[model samples]
Target: MTQLHYDVVIIGAGAAGMVCAIQAGYRGLNVLLLDHAPKPGAKIRISGGGKCNFTNRRVEPKHFICANPHFVKSALARYQPEAFIEWVERHNIAYEERDNGQLFTLEGAGQIVAMLRTELDWAGVELQLNCDVVAVIKQHETWSISTSQGQLTSAKLVVATGGLSYPKLRASDFGMKLAKQYGLEVIPSRPGLVPLQMPARQRAWWSDLSGLSLEVAVTAQRGPRFEGAMLITHQGLSGPCILQVSNYWQPGEPISLNLLPDVKNVAEWLLDLKQNAQSLSGALKQHWPKRLVQAWQTKFEFDDHLANYTQLRLDQLGTSLTAWSIYPDDTAGYAKAEVSLGGVSTDEVSSKTFETHKVSGLYFIGEVLDVTGHLGGFNFQWAWASAHACAQDL
Candidate 1:
């Protein structure tokens, strides 16, 4: 195998690795970008339904969660949404702003990947695709990366293998494994941004509710909560709300959904229509889809008649609507996940640089590290931020 030398050798040519390579090359370091994929940015190609929600305008440190909590500020502060926007403007990529300041390409996700490739090319970074790295070792201050075809040496080793979100996109646990090999702490990895399944009995009761969606606040007890649309699928609950909460969810806990949050006077509203006595199902039908009303009627004993029902029945129904408890079967697992949560532990690396404190010249970036962002382009922002952090120090 050919032996090549570089000032920096980056593994995984995804968002983080590519960005790191560009920054490192700008510093006049001989940079080599490696990935097992035939091309770069497969995740970028499929992200945000192909338009690519690149970043959010409103990004605070609170939008992220990590064991250390404060490890992301430095990198995120260095290359924030504005900087990325400037880069987009530089490339003249047409984009449109969506809800909550999410930026998407008017052209396509491919343009974003092209722009990244263009930056790497301009900075004189060597791009090596389809190179499966077998192992990495540190001798003195340099890290030697061994691949199927050749050996490369560098003073800096970046594990940008990302997470096992899209296994078809070449996701691997290599990053986490590498951290462990070097005696760095690693968080247990699991699926995120995925749907949850239902128990057999629960599925039967809510089976008719499949394909139904409604705006709600879904919160797992003692975990992250989200307010958005909840969708009932063949498996269980999905949609933005469920996906967001799954990142912080633990097993054996029930989710509480506020069906009518911020809505007051439900009892009074029914009372106002006392002139027309409607069945409990018929009254709810006026507000929700006919199918949804039917499903609820089948599951719960509701009092529809405002004048005929006792005060106790009315009060109970109002409370039930406010807090609907539903225990899901399980998450859709890794297949449908957008990203993987839990990775190389934050304690293992320097927050400022993402390099191992115990093992010098070894860096971890993007989803490979234990940092995860909320849905809506925060993950991509993380990819850019963490990469920029280590590249500056590299």
Candidate 2:
């Protein structure tokens, strides 16, 4: 078996790991980054439909979900979105800002990966791909890692293995497992930024409305309200709105969706329609897809004209339109999840340096920590911020 050593070794070659390696190497540390995959940045290559939402113009600690909400503030404050924007600019990477301050590459996601690789090369960081780690053991002050390639040691170790989302990308629970091995607490993990599945009873009806999408304001029972486009799928609900709420959705909890998101007052509009005695079908057609309107006609059996609806019925319809409660069967799970919620408990690590409180020379960053960000570029920003913070200490 071959043996090697480095001043700092980072596991996972994805966003956080790569950025951490670059920062540490630039600090003149002998850095080695390892990944089990054949290529680095598989997640980055596929993010934002290959365009790569790398950061957001407006980033706040509020965008993240963690057991300790305040834990992310330090790192995120130290390395803001403008810092990454500056870094991208230095690399001559062209990017554009979309709705809600999401910043994506104007070219392609591959450009971001290529730029990171180039920076890694310039920083003199050794990147070893297709290297699977079997075990990690700490002896004295050194971390001894056993891998498929060989045994290696490092004075400092960074576990940026991320969370258990995107299993096809070789994402694993190795970081959490390592934390357990070192006596650190790990929060139970669940799928985040994923779509919700409808109940079996509603599946047939929802399936009929598949491919239909509409703007909506959706709120989970305990989560914040998000205004975005909601898509009806064969199984259930998706798109930006549903994905945003999925982070806070719990089993058996109902989600309230405002179907008429643009309408200032649905009751007033319905009353006006009543006065005009307009056909309900025609009024609904203006807002919904033809098929969806047809489905509603079949399910709700609306009166031919608004004049027929009693005052009480109109009040009920207004409430239904404003807050339609839906109970989801479950989430799409890790396979369809963009990220995972829950991880190494933030209380066990330093928010400034991302190093473990229980174990010296050990650190956890990115999604592997308890921090999970909202959709868009917030997760990537967390990755960059946490990595930069960890690298500075290394």
Best by lDDT: 2
**Which regions in candidate 2 have their CA more than 4 angstroms from the true location?**
1-3
The number of residue pairs in model 1 that clash at the backbone is 4
The whole-model C-alpha lDDT of candidate 1 against the native structure comes to 0.84
- Residues 1-394 of candidate 2 have per-residue lDDT tens digits of 2238899999999999999999999999999999999999999999999999999988988898998889989999999999889889998999999999999999999999999999999999999999999989999999999998999899999999998999999999999999998889999999999999998998999998999998899998886899999999999999999999999999988999898888898999999999998887788889888888778767766665779888988987787777988899899999999999999999999998989998999999999999999998999999999999999999
- The numbered model that scores best in TM-score is 2
Show how many residue pairs clash in every candidate, following the order shown: 4, 0
Candidate 1 regions with alpha-carbon error over 4 angstroms: 1-3, 262-283
Instruction: Quantify all predictions' global Cα lDDT against the true fold.
Output: 0.84, 0.92
Looking at candidate 2, the ten consecutive residues that score lowest on lDDT are: 296-305
